[model samples]
Target: MAHKNQFQLLASRRFLPFFLTQFLGAFNDNVFKSALMVMIAFRLAADQANALNNLAAGLFILPFFLFSATAGQLADKYDKAFLIRRIKLAEIGISLVGVVALISGSNTLCLAVLFLLGVQSAFFGPIKYAILPQHLRKTELVGGNALVEMATFVAILGGTIVGTILSGASDSGGGSEWIGGLIIAIAIVGYLVCRVIPDAAPPVPDLKIDLNPVRQTAHVLREVAKTPAIFYAIVGISWFWLLGAAYLTQIPSFGKNVLGGDEPLVALLLCSFTIGVAIGSLLCERLSGGRIELGLVPLGAAGLTYGGIALSVIGGNLAPLEEVSLAAFWGSPGAQMFLFHLALIGVFGGLYIVPLYAMIQERTAKALRARVIAVTNIMNSLFMVVSAVLGIVFLSLLDFSIPQFFMVIALMNAAVAIFVFSKVPEFAMRLLVWLLSHTMYRVRHEGLEQIPAEGPAIIACNHVSYVDALLLAGAVRRPIRFIMYKPIYEIPVLHFIFRTGRAIPICSRQKDPEGYARAFEEIEQGLKDGDLLCIFPEGQLTKDGEMQPFKAGIEKILQKTPVPVIPMALRGLWGSFFSHKDGHAFTTWPKRFWSSVSVVAGKPLDADTAKSDHLHQVVLGLRGERL
Candidate 1:
């Protein structure tokens, strides 16, 4: 059965076993790690406990740095389902060792177990993401990713709480044996759950394994550098992890120092952020209409910045109290606002990350997908470590207050977003298209599925307004290269989008013969490169709310590059502000706001029969008096 929403995947065998395995694994890891940290804190001296906690954290992250490259090779060389089962079995053995360590009170053994768990996680990391595309359809990618992200954060929150509670119970005269049993039970169950996962055959089964971590990691990084879009996506994902880690690490301190709240209040803060992320992650599928929407990335960035700035301002306004209770903290100035901003950051964070992950998985070559994921994991580890170091420098050495540090991080986020988006203008162009489609008009697409999913094709449409290209861009899933009149292509802000979208600008032969030739050269190159190209068959916008006669430019295009042509029409745009209805385009006030518009596409027509007149008739019939 087809799934309408991400949650429905939970009920299907194709996804359920894998989802449970991933969720259980993350849950078990955090449970053990949190329990270990809590146990050390309560049992050892304050200084000793602090040192061991830091050591434990370092141990967990070290495996990714050391073994990730090798692990990526293994994932690419073997069935992921088989690897996952083996990894889960190893987790059971590790948990058995952890049980003995916890009950025997051996700090060294506990740290060793932590390191082993990290190793297990490192090996599983690449397979976890790489397997999704093997199982899910292209349309389901975003939803699948959203569900996974939501589950992961939820697992973190749930596991942390459970571990903390179990550790506290032990401190209150409960025996350590209970914690041990629970850990062993979780590991065993995880193994059982993973056993049923469907086999994911390796993409590069014949590839030789590289045993050296340094050489393999360097090699992988070089491969990743070849695709700048995927590389920057990895950077963007890593930066997000850094940002998230910074906020999570500081929250407890923020609660106690800034708000003068207790452990309970700190937990509440954590809940706010985690729950918000869960909501936002789930919302991604809905917001993007189940597609990997790049537009949401910029929106998420904006929300994160706003949330951070608001938090800093609210935090600066608060007065620290002496041991404030949760109830009293709620009554204190800015408490509600503080929590809201934290949650907002998390919500936008979810919006920011899901699409990026889906994009990486979809765009990367299948043979190298796992290794690319491995590179991202390594970068994530490094960025998180850097975040910790920077935290120390800002809050300790630089003597910046918590609020000021927050402000600095927010500004850094802005700067980083600008750098990434500017480097890849597709993101910025998507943002503009998404905003225009969502705000200025309500666009309904018809027969869009007729557009080819891959390969080169031409789209000949009736151009009703200057914004028709933007609307079409948003409506179609694949990116399009527009062939537009030079004057319209050069509209200030719109020019940035068109140029970034690699649009071709042309003038009449009499006006500029050289420019006209260059435009056709670009068009031919674009088609040769397997790009989707769109042209306004009418040549220009209509002077009235009526169909304009199709021009010969499309015929010229087809003569040179005979791709299948899809006739399209835009309705309800003729009288809009961007159209020349009562006066020249954009010269008069808008006739309406959030007006209804429709983009109707027809089935592909053979290049030989798709003459200008025939295509114009088809588009007009499709439009069907809507204007």
Candidate 2:
């Protein structure tokens, strides 16, 4: 069957209603929170209001730590659509509580309402994320997540604007009735929309509700730790939330203290971030072309770090200013630059998050997916809390300005990224592969499905360039451990990627007997472990545009672990950048920028027919006179 377009899901019964429901939920959360913040900033005591703001943020996040584990159990045990409806209806009741808080002007009651809604959001969190894999196709996950995140931040932008506006009006002798009415109205509409969401069959209808959040969290966390990759992904996702919470939670203070702007300018700062995130989110689908490409994580880290530090450096030395016209502010030498840096952070954030979410959905088993997501939520909440504490330490204790704290956050992102990448080298491998595919060369893959989707396989291809491994890695959806010469594997910049990718480094027995023996041992173990390992059967990169004789090492490796031999061919890499076609690679200019390249995988050769001579002819045929 032909696959349907992912965006089309938005128009169908599967996605649109769910999207609206979540968007509204996020919108409502922000609306009430922002309204309270506006009141505290504009009308309340300065010190007391600042303390309340911090407390408000903590109250909203506390429920996730307390309830996400239970929420995960419930999602797996019941109908998600029904659960959403109930949650939305609860939202209405809670907004009414907000009515009490708003009408009486009780900061205490408002905070209590915030905590209750946070509890509601905690329950809603697991189902919202876990439902996508239940409805959407695997290929559509990235696009779906992109759209969902885009709508979410945009809703945040909406809530910030609308809620602030209403609260502002309420403050002007309207007696808070205006804000109260609007919030309740929004809640009812959310419940109505959630009612239309399609139902997904519960994965474990008979799943016993584990009422103990602590025990349940521990058990689910054990399930999460069973898979190292998924656990690392959870950590990465949590760290992202930490960074986001740190930056976003400070927008109000950052604008006022650093940019010298008022509430209106704070709104503009958030709006820029939301718009930038939306743009970046939408760009994910086009960039990934429907797959969960983990490569973007590292790239996003780079942007996030760069943007944060740049903001810190640029925002220093600026004096506070009175509330001024935005037109005048935008004309200031530094305002737009600050916004640009903030926006850049959001853009990279979108790039970072969508892929990680899709990866979790794509890789995890259906049974444990929701529970795993819950663990991620719990960790995210914890990290956000840590971010808050860090903000206090840096600002109140260490006497750092908000802009200077941005630099500290940037360093935090870098440290976390390096730590996670060290734990899972696949991220590093994909980054190199993605960069090669996107920047210096455009790879057109052919006959990729001819290779087994998952299994032990040895791919033999002509190595036409120094980057042939990268091109092949980028071409195939699966990760491949390549066998390369030790010298090449140890190249200064490329070494880190090669080592992270677990590329088997070989040398002639005469050159290094121990290394050569270790290479074969590793290759045999990898194939036994059901890994895809790609090797240049010619044993080295072709000096000219022609296939070299297949190396005898392949025969030896296959003798030890005889897997299906997949023959691949690289065409149009000769004379291009990274190719030794004209002279030394990287020493010569690319024949042209963005040169076209193709990697073709032919049918897997049966063991009896997988002789070196026969497979050589097959690859040569696939190359088809490209030389």
Candidate 3:
């Protein structure tokens, strides 16, 4: 079957409502927060402005620390659609309170409303991620997440622009109250849209709600710890938020105080940053080939650090132009230069985050996914709080200007990224594989990460093409030991590559008992040394696309040295030049530059259930119904 296009997936009722709901929520968040910030900056007491603005920011983020644990538990325990609707209803109520505060003209009440909005977001956090896998197929996860991310950043830009414009206009005509009312009205519309979100069944219906924040938070942390990769991914995500929060909080002040820009200029700076993120998000689907490819995280982080430094350097170089014109202010040569740097930052940001989000969804178990996301939110909030405090300390004690501070942050981001990638060589190795596959062919992967990073992993895949091993090897980050037929393993030119890759030659027991014994012994030794050993249980390459009967060799190997057996299925390989399906194998390569293929890896099966028939069926399921 032909794969579904991005438009079709995006247009479905299942996805659109949730998309709109999330977009609206993000938009409203920025609108309200930006509007309030503007009010404090321009209208509030001048001497108290900084203190109050800082306090307001703190209040808004405090709810995440206090309520995210509860929110995560609730999302996992209840139907997501119902939970979302109720959250929307609460937004409507919060917006009403904003209206009342505006009419009453009380800054205190307005700040209180901001705090309430934060609480509302904390509740919505878990449902946002938990609902995704339910609505999207495994193939669509990357694209779906990209769209959601794109929409969110776009909404953030829109919100900042709207809030700035509305707040400025209100300042002139004493219509700030009316604008506040209008914001509330928009929020109510958002709630109504959320009501139309399709139902998603809860993952754990009988899951008890853990009301104790500390205990619940601990429980979620323990759950994440079960998967080492997932735990690290969470830490990476938290670090991103920390880096982002600090940079975002500094931008407005940077533009106004450092760059000598006005309110509109500050909005433009934010817009540039967010637009970069949106672009990055959209590019993820194409780059990852519709899978959660974590390799891009390093690439994205590199861009962020580079862009930040570029922006800072540009800021330091600011000078008076020939004419004091609006165009000069908006797009002077220097301003243009800065904007270019910001856009690069956005492009890279897109590369870094999209894959991480996809990995989190793909790796975690279904039941615990939402709660894990909730844990992420809590971490994000805590990081942001820390960032705010750090920003204040750095600025006050060291007297670092905004430009200098951003430079420091850029350097810090680079340092942290280096640390992460070094600790996880798998990321770097995957990046190498990703680069090779994209350069050579339009490769698609389903279960690439299923291959054990270390130790004995018996990869049972249906033999379809000569390139199957290459594709599998490229997808996996670890070195693999492929048990191959002796004839193919001795091919003059290909033999060198195979030998270097440490592939073992295997022969039928009746044909060569010594060769068979050697292959089995080699595999056992590999397991002892913690190496990934892959065997095609089908024994020979398929002449046609249909699967062949399982070879009992895999059963024998496991019987003697039992280890985790991972079942895999490779699709769209039969018709390629490497496959024997055509009159002459390797005669003609596929015409398309990026034709899609899928390699799915199912959950590891224990040795006891690793029977030949059961393993055969599992491989078929991973391949889906396509082949």
Top TM-score model: 1
- Range of the 10 consecutive residues with the lowest summed lDDT in candidate 2: 1-10
Superior by TM-score: candidate 2 or candidate 3: 2
Per-model C-alpha lDDT, please? 0.89, 0.84, 0.79
Q: Best lDDT goes to which candidate?
A: 1
Candidate 3 achieves a global lDDT of: 0.79
lDDT of 1 by residue, 1-627 (tens): 447899988887778899889998899898889999989999999999999999999999999999898899999999999999999999999999998998888999999999999999999999889999999987788899998999999998888888888888887665467778888898899899888899999999999998898899899889888767788889999999998999888988998877778778889999999988988899999987787888999899889888989988998998886547887888887888998999999999999999999999998889999998988899999999999998999999999988888898999999999998877777887787777767777778899999998899999888788888888887887778999989999999889878877899987889999999999998988998899999987777788778888888888888999999988888988788888888998899887888889998999998899998888899899999888
* Model 2 spans > 4 angstroms off: 1-9, 37-48, 104-109, 173-175, 222-227, 257-260, 584-587
All candidates: TM-score: 0.94, 0.92, 0.78
Top-down lDDT ranking: 1, 2, 3
**Model 3, span 362-391: residue lDDT tens:** 777888888899899998888788787779
Better of 1 and 3 by lDDT: 1
- Candidate 1, which segments miss by more than 4 Å at Cα? 218-226
- Which 10 consecutive positions of candidate 1 have the poorest summed lDDT? 171-180
